[model samples]
Target: MMRARTRKLIGTVALIIFLGVYAWVAAVIGAGRISLAPAWAQFAYFLAAGLLWVLPAGLLIRWMQRAD
Candidate 1:
């Protein structure tokens, strides 16, 4: 069984890396593709992209909390 502390540390690191990569990709997309989108579409796209990260993060948190 994995230790709680280890899981936490690993989860934290993974989350940080994931967020960094996700943000970079989002930024690149925003700069390249989203810039040409209409105002309302840009708003919706950014809003969806911003919130989508939470889904995977939630799963990661749940996994990190497991006692096993």
Candidate 2:
């Protein structure tokens, strides 16, 4: 029980940090490159960037919920 709780706490903190960093990086790249692209390309890039974090986050959430 303690292990699971610990995992959840760590994972939550890690997820928050990961999301913050990821959003910063994505914004940087988008401003640097995607901003200059065509409208459709910029839209595509933003769409992909927006959803890309879900995969890793989902995995982390699964790991956090797993039994010890």
lDDT per residue (tens digit) for residues 1-68 in model 2:
55999999999999999999999999999999788899999999999999999999999999999998
Residues 11-61, candidate 1, lDDT per residue (tens digit)? 999999999999999989989979999999899989999999999999999
Per-model lDDT: 0.95, 0.96
What global local distance difference test value does model 1 have? 0.95
Per-model TM values vs. the true structure: 0.92, 0.93
Q: Give each prediction's root-mean-square deviation over alpha carbons.
A: 0.9, 1.6
**Structure candidate 2, residue pairs in collision:** none
